[model samples]
Target chain A: EAGVAQSPRYKIIEKRQSVAFWCNPISGHATLYWYQQILGQGPKLLIQFQNNGVVDDSQLPKDRFSAERLKGVDSTLKIQPAKLEDSAVYLCASTLRSGRVYNEQFFGPGTRLTVL
Target chain B: AQSVTQLDSQVPVFEEAPVELRCNYSSSVSVYLFWYVQYPNQGLQLLLKYLSGSTLVESINGFEAEFNKSQTSFHLRKPSVHISDTAEYFCAVSTANAGGTSYGKLTFGQGTILTVHP
Candidate 1:
């Protein structure tokens, strides 16, 4: 089975510029997530989508970041007016369901964003 | 709120040597714990998890972690490390009562970089 797929394995943008990353989750997966991993830190959940509907986005920076899963299959995360602090890898992951049961999540290689 | 902390930011060990990576968590309620490994330029992969039963959990890769409720710690250990074991490891936690909607949403600690030198 194919794993989660993400585009532009690496990206470079200047501060104040906008950047966008794309993700296509595993087939038949019902839950999708976006996470930001800064250097030396574990991934921080930015947002979660349950079949196109947002489940959680409390940690997302609404002022600068936005994400959407149009068909609940592929997803896109955008950052406008990027700052140096936003330089980090953006990972996308998926799971089979949106239930309480323990399920393994498959992750993409992630899009490494470097804001200069 | 739940939070996890990995005490060691980096650990260097010779191949075939025993190693331990310590983790601690703070939560007012019961939580499910997990360990994830990430090789270079790769995404995080589940190593093992601790839910309700069995304080000790082992991964297929020969890595094991013991959930110590009394000490509020879950430390990953391996009897003999391999060069392949070199990677970044993360400890995570999720509230048991988070329910279906928020069930798998995890709070992760700063990662520990394990370097196994051959």
Candidate 2:
């Protein structure tokens, strides 16, 4: 089975510029997530989508970041007016619906965003 | 709120040597614990998980972790290491959301970089 897929494995942008990352989850997966991983730190959940609806986005920076999963299959995360602190890897993950057994998440090769 | 802590930033060990990576977590409710491995330029892969029942979980790759509820710790260990085992190990925890909209929103710890030299 194919795993989660992401685009533009690497990206570079200047401060104040805008950048966007894309993610296509595994087939039949019902849940999708976006995470940010800074150097030396674990990936932090930025937002979660259950189908096309948002499940959680408490940690997301609404002032600069936005994400959407219109069809609930692919997702896009955008950062406007990027700052130097936004330099980090953006990871996307997906999982099947929760059942009696716990669902395991599969991740994609993240997009390494370098904001100069 | 929930949080995970990886005690070590980096660990260097010779090939065939035993190694352990320590993790501890804090949470108010019941949680599911997991260990993920990320090779250079790759995505995170599940190493193992502890949801319930047995406190000890083992991965097919000779890696094992024991979940100690009393101590709130889950430490990954391997009897012998190989150069291929070098990667960043992350510890994470998740719990069922009260609203029932999601189940796997994970809170991760700062990762531990394990370098196995051959």
Q: In candidate 2, residue A67 scores what lDDT?
A: 99
Q: In order, what DockQ does each candidate have?
A: 0.66, 0.62
TM-score of chain A of 2: 0.97
Weakest ten-residue segment in model 2 chain A by summed lDDT: A96-105
Tell me the docking grade of candidate 1.
medium
Which candidate tops lDDT? 2
Tens digits of lDDT, candidate 1, A3-32? 899999999999999999999999999899
Q: What lDDT score belongs to each candidate, Candidate 1 first?
A: 0.89, 0.92
Model 1 chain B: lowest-lDDT 10 consecutive positions: B95-104
Predicted structure with the largest TM-score when compared to the true one: 2
The clash count for each model shown is 0, 0
* Residue ranges of candidate 2 with Cα displaced over 4 Å: A100-102, B97-102
TM-score of 1: 0.94
Score chain B of each candidate by TM-score: 0.92, 0.92
TM-score of chain B of 1: 0.92
Superposed model 1: Cα runs more than 4 Å off: B98-102
